[model samples]
Target: MIYAIGAVVGLIGGIKVYNKFSSGDPDTSKTAASWFGACIFLIVAATILRSFFL
Candidate 1:
């Protein structure tokens, strides 16, 4: 349940980050990739931590 919640949050955050960074006519692909990667990392970390500790 906690992991699910964390994943949802991460997905929402990732979408927001992607939108925020992917705007305008610039080279935002890298920025969006990094943000999405960070979001995935957060989700995985949260799931692992919750499963092991809580």
Candidate 2:
């Protein structure tokens, strides 16, 4: 379930990044980094929580 959510978030982030890139947005790198960070945070948080609970 956690991974599924992550995948969905990643897909959304990918599309947003791709759109920014195609439109030549100057802040695209920052946006991409933030999105990537969010996804990684989610995965790490889930792992930590699962370890604590199970």
Candidate 3:
């Protein structure tokens, strides 16, 4: 369900952050930022929908 999607977003964010701080291109920071945003959106949307549905 939505929780699964949200978890995926979180994992993506973690990978992005790790990449940005570890061995990724410095110019790819924006990609990491986008992942952070996606994680926020997924968590918020999931929370709202979960609240509504259950």
User: Top lDDT: which candidate number?
Assistant: 2
RMSD in Å for candidate 3, one decimal?
A: 2.5
lDDT of each: 0.69, 0.96, 0.78
**Which lDDT tens digits does candidate 2 get at residues 1-54?**
898999999999999999999999999999999999999999999999999999
Question: After superposing candidate 2, which stretches have Cα over 4 Å from the reference?
Answer: none
TM-score of each: 0.52, 0.96, 0.58
lDDT winner, 1 or 2: 2
Model 3 ranges off by over 4 Å? 16-24
Give per-residue CA lDDT, model 1, range 1-54, as digits (tens): 655765676777667666766676365677667756866777778778878987
Which tens-of-lDDT digit does each residue in 23-49 have in candidate 3?
756757777778878878877887888
Q: lDDT value for candidate 2?
A: 0.96
Worst lDDT window (10 residues) for model 3? 24-33
Residue 10 lDDT, candidate 2, scale 0-100:
96
lDDT of 3 at 40: 81
Give the runs in model 1 whose Cα sits over 4 Å from its true position: 1-25
Model 2 TM? 0.96
